[model samples]
Target: METLEAADMTQLLMESHELSTMINQSREVSDYLSAKRQMEADVEAQRLLALFEKKKEQYEDVQRFGKYHPDYNHISKEVRELKRTIELLDSVQAFKRAEDSLDELLYQVSRTIANAVSGTIKVPSNNPFLEAQSSGCGTGGSCGCSVKKPS
Candidate 1:
């Protein structure tokens, strides 16, 4: 039985490796890698990214000490503006789209595998009641009570 289990594990590992290779060779992943390289080569983007990181560290340090500063808000806004500027670049946009596509694909694949293994897991859908419950309103006298039933 132990030998059989080991063999099964080995086979699973081999299949997983092949799947990873296929995903790496996919067009979305290739585009993402190319865009990442382009972004790395961009001087202005790097400068803005460095500034954002520095500001983020400062904001986090203030938060860690349980103190709020106007500078934190200012830094946050500046970081957001810098992010928007960086996102406007064609390479950055392409990278973001490609990354999102790959993320969505991976999510679906994991969900499918989990469903198969667990016999249709009760995953949440976009139902209003479920949404209300997930949004922390399941109590009888809470906002969930205001949700009208489907006629």
Candidate 2:
């Protein structure tokens, strides 16, 4: 019985590796990689991203002091504006869309695998909308559909 279990585990590992390779070769991944490369190669986008990161760090520092900090409002506004500017870049927008697409595809694959193992198995997702919709807990588990602990 132990030997059979070991064989099954090895087979499962090999199959998972194949699945990973297939996913890596998928169009979603290809688009994501292309968009990422474009974003990285854009000089303006890189500059804006660096500025955004610096402003975001400043915002985090001021956040701890709340509104009482002298630079809080300025830092907050700067971060927001920088973020908006970054988002407006074509390369940044394309990268974000491709990333989201790839994320959704991976999420679907995870959900399929989990459901195959057991229908009750809940698959965690990066997208909040997917988590709520896929888990049948549309109301965020307030309707008594929450997972129960085994007694």
Model number with the top TM-score: 2
Segments in model 1 whose C-alpha atoms lie over 4 Å from true places: 1-7, 64-70, 119-151
Q: Candidate 1's residue-wise lDDT over 1-151, tens digit each?
A: 3553334888889998998898788877887788789888888878878887887787677666443665766666776787788788776787778777776556555545655655234334434443333233234474445422222
Q: Give, for candidate 1, the lowest lDDT window spanning 10 residues.
A: 130-139
Query: In lDDT terms, which candidate is top?
Result: 2
Give the root-mean-square deviation of each candidate in angstroms: 7.3, 4.8
lDDT, residue 22, model 2: 99
Candidate 2 wrong stretches, greater than 4 Å: 1-7, 136-143, 146-151
Which clashing pairs does model 1 show? Answer: none
Q: Write the per-residue lDDT of candidate 2 for residues 1-151, one digit (tens) a residue.
A: 3553345888889999999999999999999999999999999999988888888889999999999999999998888888888999999999999999999999889988877776567778778877766665423355777543222
- Give the Å error, residue 47, model 2: 0.1
